[model samples]
Target: MPDRNSALRGQRIHGQFGNISKEPGVTFREIKDFSYLEITLWDWARDSLRSKLAELLGIGDLPDTGDSQRLKEGRLLHLADGSLAYLGAAAPADILEVAITPEEGCVVPLGHARCLLRLEGPKAVALLRRGIREDLRDTAFAVGQVMTTDIGGIGVLLLRPDTAKFDLLVPRSHAIEVWRWLTRRAAPFGYEVL
Candidate 1:
């Protein structure tokens, strides 16, 4: 197992609302309590891995390769089918552990640096609009668009993985400040962290 102390670099604080802060600099405010099995293939064997992952996940046809291709949420899909396989969210954790191991050039619990914030309520978009410079308009940024931008003067990787939901990934050191700022902005919109 990885070092528990290293895994949790920040402190968790629970607010009056459902918001449960996992760390002072990081929080796991469940946007969608999703469980996903991710399989990353070495660069050399991406093609073979894609085919294998498709077969394993039972997705007869994978999305075409290009900027236009995207996976649907809640569906067994491949994130980067040619290089990375994602079995969708809400998968059994135990099964995920079994499918991946040290061998097969697979890395379980892919070390992706990420932080999620659950933005709900009617005015969610308005709140985000105040902080983010990017045009949050639907016409400019549709759902599932993985965007790397800045929010509240801090660099952030934003993703609208699903409608009415937004995920923000900031540097680990800035997680706490960003979370607090986000919550304050959401006040007008009636935001709930979890």
Candidate 2:
């Protein structure tokens, strides 16, 4: 795996922050280094490339739009635009090596440009509710669901892999602001940096 060089390299990294309850209700961690590849078809609705897109990425029967599924080597997310985002520990050539002429689709590597933060613990739900206006109840936002939303006016890609876990994909430039926002809200419940 590639060495982890996080966008949030500095600032309040590891160590407990905010209210120190008997037990921390939240634990925040940055997903060190991960691969991010986006495959967008020129004409998704009716394009020959759509069929081969999955083959190129080595994913079989891609997840439904707005849903994410784990792959043998990575996690697959089907975005709202009928595109696919694959995140893994390392970048593979399956999609990267494809021709992907302009007539087919576009492949984008976003590993170095985005910051991935994971918030876990019982209070994670409550903490996220304060910023994201979306309905997060288990019934409303099921696991493996991914959506684009905003927190503190910052655009974010929200992913719910489990009940008490949420992964936020934020732009590199605004990661600190979002971290501060999360820490501030989590203070009341007590948070831990791991």
Candidate 3:
């Protein structure tokens, strides 16, 4: 097994750093304790791969392009490029060893390559609106949805698993930049770097 390290290890200062707008309306922290597995299914192998995944992972159908499926351990996000990301407790080794064939699909471990950040609080939607130009209204983006977009030019996989949270999966290299940008902008709303 590879060593586990945090993308925002030294960058995340555990405390409120921004303006105390109505009692800290936002809080963020790196998600380091989950497995982020990526499965890229070739066009012709989609059905077989989905079946194999269902049989091996004991999970139901993957979400549609703009949605997410919550599981017991974590959640499954359907990426824009026809890839499936399972951000769960651990990689499903059985699926890798038995289900995945070259013809079926390929697995990529994104645990370390990406930085998962949990952003939540009352002002989460409001703060995200400052950078993400998406209609985040519950009626539009609704809970259990995911989208790929950019914040300050950094590509991110934004997942709304709950009504109050927006989990951002960012490239490892640019996690801190986002942290800084978010904290600075969250000042008015009051934020915590927990």
Choose the strongest candidate by TM-score.
Answer: 3
Candidate 3: list runs displaced more than 4 Å: 1-3, 91-98
lDDT for each residue of candidate 1 in 1-194, tens digit (9 for 90 to 100): 22222212343344433332432222236332443344566667656655765565456555442112233434332344433433234343344456544554564543234344555444566767888888888777777555557777888756665655666645556666777677665544343332
Question: Higher lDDT: candidate 2 or 3?
Answer: 3
What tens digits encode model 2's per-residue C-alpha lDDT throughout 17-67? 778858899999898677777777676442565556567666676688889
Top candidate (lDDT): 3
Give the residue spans of candidate 1 off by over 4 A. 1-40, 61-115, 153-157, 169-173, 190-194
Predicted structure 1, TM vs. truth? 0.56
Compared with the true structure, all predictions reach lDDT values of 0.50, 0.80, 0.81
Which pairs clash inside model 1? 11-23, 11-24, 35-90
Question: TM-score for each prediction?
Answer: 0.56, 0.88, 0.90
**lDDT tens digits by residue: candidate 3, 55-122:** 66666776788887777677777886558878767645434534677677777877778888998999
Q: Ranking under TM-score, best-scoring first?
A: 3, 2, 1
